[model samples]
Target: MSPRRRRTEEFTSYYGRPVLKEPTWEALDIAGYIFAGGLAGASSILAAGAQHTGRHRLERAAKLTALTAISASVVALVHDLGRPERFVNMLRVAKPTSPMSVGSWILSVYGPLAGASAAANVLGIFPRAGKAAGIGAGITGSAVATYTAVLVSDTAVPAWHDAHDVMPFVFAGSAAASAGGVAAALAPLAEGGPARRMAIAGAAVETAMSLTMERSGKLSAETFHQGRAGTLLRLSKGFTVGGAVGLALGGRSSRLVSTLSGLSVAAGSALLRFGVFEAGRASTRDPKYVVVPQRERLEQQGRGASDRQGAAAGADSMG
Candidate 1:
């Protein structure tokens, strides 16, 4: 556990393990969580951001999106649990190393915060929590967005593990874009300036990050370029592009255009989750995805390496 010490025998990743042929999780399952978590956080941030800039309509729409996303995410998380009725069993023990336990705790906190914020938006309740609760919601939202990366990475899943850093940003941007889209659709454009900006910005970030990761040699985005994964990725790209273009025009004048545009963003966001999730699983299904790059890393590590120094250097290389 010493940070300074070096140990070559320590397991950096699972490659030669005998317990499993290949490791993977269902794409839909994984992406569903990504979508929910992202939506929740994005909504909260949009809501708080609106309130800070003094936009009540924007704030309300954002909170509603957050509330709805939190609700669906809760359901999806539980549904993914093998025993839905015993999903609470996760809380029986708390372990920091276990992302689920940590995420569960985060969700527990965020649920209430999101709920309170939404209620405040309605009933003309306490507006003070808008910022306070939003801050908490955003923190938890990020966790929700990125924890899926940790979850998938911790497993023997090749695609997920390799793209850990990039994945978080992808989910974050996608979520923000999705929530922003919803705000755009539900609110009038004139009143939806903040949401419009957030949606555009978030979508741009998501598209850019995804493209970079797809091109990165280390992350090996090629695994995601084929079959069902490819289809989903393409769908996400199309929707995102369409949404962004629509927003570029003065969508404010035409309610139909604004609504459709927002819908496209939301759709793209959801597809992003599905695509990444499937890609990870698909990578897991193919032993090559794991054995190839991992062996490449180990081979690199076997030759002149320091855990800290190497990681930092790798970070720069990837950047």
Candidate 2:
């Protein structure tokens, strides 16, 4: 009934009562965290893959990066929970309404794939084993890059849910850019072609989707325009564009340029994730973003009903 009363009752002997003073946890579903971590892990795998041969050192570094990211992801996921130990309970019965449940499943799937992929890299001193790890890494690397888009899109957050059609591509692009950066850092000029191509492609996808989303979706785009979200969104664009241009110019001859571009792409991709995270929080922070558009949709439905009723009456009169 009342705030204080609710708090008093919360700690009472009563059962099934919830707590007051909600944690200022950005109101983010644990799914978001898992998704971010999963993407990071996937990106690392891609980075490890740029050279198909003669670059064991780079691959080794990439493997470690991927494993660390995956482990961090698992840790962040557990930390996000109220009952950390019961986190596995998520797999028992999935409630689709819960993003966290779906995310838990995604991470569960990605975790093993990443582990399997890195096994060979970890056993690198064993030449045959390393080759096997490379093959596994390629497949798992793609998964690491893509699945999080699904996780975010399934949410009710206006920015995220509304961007479902393009979200996957956006994520793919970001991962590619990140991976490309890793490649550029490690690969020689001749070997850098694929990574450069990936960087350009990723930047293009991110920029296009961002611009299209901004223009076509008002409420969804509002997430980017407001507060800190605006800053991150802008920064993501700038870095993506700059990095892509550098890659296009062939960053090989000048290590400095390559490094700068790679870092820029990585920064842009990270900003994109963090920005969208904030946007989702902002979308749900106030009632207007949620209520107004839904109300409008309802009103449109009412109008359509009225028109249908009138048309039906006219048909009856004609009969």
Candidate 3:
């Protein structure tokens, strides 16, 4: 009789449930907060640069945009927490190791600076103080734009945690692209050169980093390219690339083209944020994303230990 063949057991969780609990964040609230924060942060930086360059219209538009976006982001955050006091309560203690704590502090500081800058610009008062506030906002705005990536990556979600190395860059690029697009669409063509350049560069970086992340060859990476997340990401890539091309080819010659292209890029950035959020949520529903990586790590450790033991045994025998 032939030897009985051993069956390979498939990985399964207790009661076929997910190994990790999915995040309870609402898609609209959390993803919108992410998009708005990035837009606000990048707009502040662009506004500061435009001011120094004598692009008054662009600077004013960017400042207002930053203020509005940040305000919306705060509202979304508060809504997600289910109570306004919950957000304020986060300020009761400062925990440097906690991303949520740090993010709350960042929002607190950035919000006032952004508001001050926008108010001074619109009212044409406190010119020097407004400039200072704009500068401060620009500095903190960077942290605001990229901190969400850190916050998400710090979680136990396989998709977000595994891509920590590239997530910040992706978020930063998306922020710049969206900010630049909005500024370019709103500002006069004569003053939009810088905005156009920023949009193009940001789109390139966003696309490259996203591709690098998807190609990481980990089981978690598959979450990005399957189901609803995949569809959203694919559409985002198309819009971003198409918008950049349109800006490069016709942005200088026509206002309509520039506006359309800028809007496209902004839309793409928003979609990307939603897609990333969805991917993390989807990863938590699958046990393989959590189990396979842990198993692989243990197997590697086992092989290394065995090799070390054999080497030690050989050395003792020779002695």
lDDT of 1 by residue, 42-113 (tens): 788787777778787888888888888888877766666756766688778889989878877888888998
Residue 237 of model 3, lDDT score = 97
What's the number of clashes in each of the models?
0, 0, 0
Off by over 4 Å in 1: 1-27, 126-135, 297-319
In model 3, the worst 10-residue window by lDDT is 1-10
Candidate 2 worst ten-residue window by lDDT = 13-22
Q: Residue 76, candidate 1: how far off, in angstroms?
A: 0.9
After superposition, candidate 2 runs with Cα above 4 Å error: 1-58, 82-84, 92-102, 125-134
Q: What's the lDDT for all of these models?
A: 0.76, 0.66, 0.93
Candidate 1 global TM-score = 0.82
Residue-level lDDT for 68 in candidate 2: 65
Q: What is the C-alpha RMSD of each candidate to the true structure, in Å?
A: 8.7, 8.1, 3.4
Question: Best by lDDT, which number?
Answer: 3
Model 2 clash pairs are none
Which pairs in model 1 have colliding backbones? Answer: none
TM-score of 3: 0.96
lDDT of 1: 0.76
